[model samples]
Target: MTVELRVLPPLLVSLAVTVVLAACTRVPPPPPPESREGFPERGARLIQQYGCGGCHTVPRVPRAEGLVGPPLTRFGARSYIAGELPNNAENLRRWIQDPQSVEPGTAMPDLGVSETDARDIAAYLFTLE
Candidate 1:
């Protein structure tokens, strides 16, 4: 005995292909660049990638209303770093490079930000004024 398989109609096949092609043709929107001084576009990307908003409140980044850590809105204007070290670029760099070194047992961990990224993040944080 011989068996025959039914084939889908050509019109249905073409319509399915058209629907798939249209779905695949979608384009994603480009990221918005940070226009603030010191906080370059790259730094903003890094901040989002590093999950900074998971713990701290970062301006402009949506869903960054976390309160696990201190609000960074006034980090630049703060008089002291970690409530002990003086606030400055150098000190901020040190803190970002290794938070545990500056304050052992602190809940904050160093996210391994490079010197350049640290400066940019700090610049953005400072602009929170």
Candidate 2:
């Protein structure tokens, strides 16, 4: 019993230290998929086609000045979507597909965006950084 108690304390301490150290270390997320490459250009075209400029002020997009919705100038650096969901590729795509679903009664209408188009749009949005 005495031997076990001494050994257990040291083992527990070592385990706790290991866990703390591991938690303190961070591993960066992997790079975006290769298939998403060359999508920004297409996404830019889609944005223009969708008339997104009618609502938000998008950088590099001509006549993308409006006061209805929030500006998407630094959209890529934003941390949240509609200030609700995390600003990731998947969430962005979902929001693009169905803004009402993500946030009911939102002014941003669902443009019936297809999955491929959503992905491309996301790629372009992330490029704003």
The candidate that achieves the highest TM-score relative to the unseen native structure:
2
TM-score of model 1 (CA atoms) = 0.64
Those runs of model 2 whose alpha carbons end farther than 4 Å from true positions after fitting are 1-38
Which ranges of candidate 1 are over 4 A from the true structure? 1-38
Assess each prediction's global lDDT (C-alpha) against the native.
Answer: 0.70, 0.83
| lDDT (Cα) of model 1 | 0.70
Please write out the lDDT profile of model 2 over residues 38-117, one tens digit for every residue: 39888888888899989988888778887799988778777778988877888888899999989999999889889999
Q: 1-129 in candidate 1: lDDT tens per residue?
A: 122223446667889999999999957533222223346456556677778889888877666777988877756566666876766667766787789999998888888888888877766665554
- Model 2 scores a TM of 0.71
Q: Which candidate has the top score in lDDT?
A: 2
